[model samples]
Target chain A: GEEVAQTPKHLVRGEGQKAKLYCAPIKGHSYVFWYQQVLKNEFKFLISFQNENVFDETGMPKERFSAKCLPNSPCSLEIQATKLEDSAVYFCASSPPHFVAKNIQYFGAGTRLSVL
Target chain B: SQQGEEDPQALSIQEGENATMNCSYKTSINNLQWYRQNSGRGLVHLILIRSNEREKHSGRLRVTLDTSKKSSSLLITASRAADTASYFCATDISGNTPLVFGKGTRLSVIA
Candidate 1:
């Protein structure tokens, strides 16, 4: 298995529709992070999880975005009422737990979501 | 504001030449990392420099960190066409904090 796996390499949805993205972290890695990149620009941190528990989510856009990671299941980020502005490539990354958290993330091939 | 900002948004060089990229940050950090992303691909981790380490070398890659200056630089020796890609610098500011990435520097190596 790959270090990190993201489902649906490309997703297309109409405005106001829902978009769901899934990620499978590497085995033995407990930390997961999600990022959004638009138009080849900088990566924007969206959320992170530590072993199925939400660790930090300050960057999440609250109105229409949510995410979850359950034990034995792939972590998922769901966006409701997708807007044209929401179009971007979503990336998933994972890292092993360390005492000092000098985390070196392993990223998955992103899922490019296009909102029409 | 972005925590890490990379200078020279893009660079072009001939094969076998050296390529160097610099990054600056605005805050204290636990560590800094460099990653490479090919077109339409996931980022590939290149190197990680801790706050206490000044320099590290792996193969043809050399990385230097200046904690006092809140900056870092990555130098790749003998650049190859295969090395062409976008390079990004990410900062780990604190424990359990998400990495803040810079707008990448696009490197184009001419064969």
Candidate 2:
């Protein structure tokens, strides 16, 4: 069984400030994904990383959101100049290289972002 | 946008009963997955059925896929009070766009 862990269960930030969330994938997993759940409803794709390289960022808001999966440190998704609409629960999920389709996915509890 | 849409936005059932949720997608997929989210928490992957497969099972959970219909369904038998949660279907649309999820079915299982 694999586990994906996210930090800072809740966050509060001003509208113009920056928000950064962290995720730690399982010990051997290679792919890390970030998704935003607005008001605990629809999940909006953000970005995904395969190891240290970003594989797909089409869903990410290039101007405001960015993510990094550096070695040693846990993966991170940062939003610069956060807005009111950015208030949502950001989930971090990880899957093994070949398991994205069939292998069981592991998700962290999530980080609730509140932009005032 | 190849989003998975779920049927019966909400459902209510009693304990020891079976809970079934259906999901329909817009396009072809490499595989379709079902996930469970408890309240405000993140999603927990329940099962993943490949495109070529018709049915899959894990414990009391059952998942069936129909490529022609572009649909899937998840069945949980002997439901319990703790099974009350939002069940969602996420489709792996054979690309790098990440998994697209449905609106989910809010299930309330009464004891």
Candidate 3:
């Protein structure tokens, strides 16, 4: 697909277990974003990366959620000590070097996480 | 939270009719974008209207942004059954800011 590729279409984890999801951005894209969608509701921004550097992580919950987009590696979002509230669809998106006019982002199919 | 709030959380319309969804936000935005999500799929960008622009169109989809009122609207003309999906509006305050999305409107286009 020409779109972002997300791994583990669906994930199941215990309350205290760890869950990690990976995303591969489209070729040549320099920006990556992570969002969490609950049911069919609004999207919550978790973090963003500009190539290998963290762009904005103010939305990240400082305690358990962490994400990285390292060189030669797929972007990954990890949830440590997952809770029931962590259950949701995690979406990954990517965009070319954003210049306002080229700010359109493409999204992945998302990884549905079920924390029991 | 600077998240946008969409009006008429749900809309039901017959095919061939026009459907409109509105979104209001609390902060100044660089641009407002509309996206569509079908069932459990990821959101696909529909249209984007910059803060300095009023309207834009792509096929049967039209998007209007009113920066003064901090609101925007997405209109799907001559809607089809395939247009049934959840529509969301996302806003960004700056080029580098992360987008804050609206709660979305579940639009049902009945055949």
Query: How does each model score on lDDT?
Result: 0.92, 0.88, 0.90
**Candidate 1 docking classification:** medium
The alpha-carbon lDDT assigned to residue B90 of candidate 2 equals: 87
Compute the DockQ of candidate 2.
Answer: 0.61
| Candidate 1 lDDT over residue span B11-107, tens digit each | 9999999999999999888989999999999999999888889999988899999998998999999999999999999998665568899998999
lDDT per residue for candidate 3 within A1-116, as digits (tens), equals 47899999999999999999999999888899999988769688999999999999988999999999999899999999999999999999998887634578899999999999
Off by over 4 Å in 1: none
lDDT of 2 by residue, A1-116 (tens): 35788988999999999999999999888888898988677998888898999988888886988999999999999999999999999998887777344545678999999999
TM-score on alpha carbons, each prediction: 0.97, 0.94, 0.97
| Pairs of residues clashing in candidate 2 | none
lDDT of 3 by residue, B3-108 (tens): 7899889999999999999999998888889999999899898888889999999999989888888889899999999999999999887775688999999999
> After superposition, which runs of candidate 3 have C-alpha atoms over 4 Å from their true positions?
none
Scoring only chain A, what TM-score does candidate 3 earn?
0.96
> How does residue B68 of candidate 1 score in lDDT?
87
Q: Report clash pairs, candidate 1.
A: none
